[model samples]
Target: MAEKIYAGVKVQVDQEGYLIDTNQWTKEIAKEIAKEEGFELTETHFAIIKFIREKVAKGEALTLRSIGKSGATDIKGFYQLFPGAPLKKATKCAGVPKPSSCI
Candidate 1:
């Protein structure tokens, strides 16, 4: 874990830049992270981010198929939204830890 400032708030993040303490997450922090990753978050993006965060809080496995099933968006749409590595980007923007399924 490493300390960093996001949205003017100090928080802990992992080596991959995912938030280590989910409690420190805020919409402003999500915006900062997404912007840093070259993504401009939209309402659709926020929906996906919230969905991923909820699933993670429940200890559910994070995966493309799982996100697709979330009804926030289909798998194909997810790919379109996040491009190359949708899951990785989504998790980061959601202020969740990097999914073990990633990397």
Candidate 2:
């Protein structure tokens, strides 16, 4: 049988950033993202991820073409701030709600 991975079960790094084993993410990632966004981890961040998750559930692609300004390029700037963040993963963690096509 294949190993099972949760929808949001990826690891989160400190300010240095972390790798995304799978497309999914984790709450720790969310908290790290909040710190990068200049905000403390809170319910709002969770809400944002839920909203993104809902969009993904609705068949929307997580691509820049679909999400607008949040295109892959957007993460380049964020990467600079965070240093080693997996751009797309970090975006997802940050509650940016990536379109299905972003990756």
Candidate 3:
């Protein structure tokens, strides 16, 4: 793990760039991470990010189907939002660990 700065905040992250501590996440941090991932955050993206964060905090398993059913967006829309490697990208930007489901 390594420490990185985002939105002027320093935080620890894994080799793949997922946050090592979700408690360090903030909207600004999320925006910076999303920007680094080549996209911008919208209310739609925030809705999904919020959903992901909540689920992770509750120790629930996260999956594409769960996210698609989140009413934030469907699977196709989720793909469109994050583009390549949607789940991995979304989890990364949401400041959560990369889901075990991802390779």
**lDDT rank, highest first?**
3, 1, 2
- TM-score leader: 3
lDDT of 1 at 4: 89
- What value does the lDDT take at residue 40 in candidate 3? 97
Mind giving the per-residue lDDT tens digits that candidate 3 earns over 14-84? 99899999999999999999999999999999999999999999999999999999999999999999999
Candidate 1 lDDT, 13-60, residue by residue in tens: 988898988989999999998888888888889999999999999998
> Which ten contiguous residues of candidate 3 have the minimum total lDDT?
94-103
Pitting candidate 2 against candidate 3, the one with the higher lDDT is 3
lDDT of each: 0.89, 0.46, 0.93
The sequence of per-residue lDDT tens digits that candidate 2 reaches over residues 1-103 is: 1232224553434333433332445677566555655655445435444545556666665543333253323434434433453335535464444333535
TM-score of 3: 0.96
Candidate 2: residue 69 Cα off by (Å)? 19
Residue 39 error, candidate 1, Å: 0.9
Mark the regions of model 3 whose C-alpha exceeds 4 Å error after superposition: none
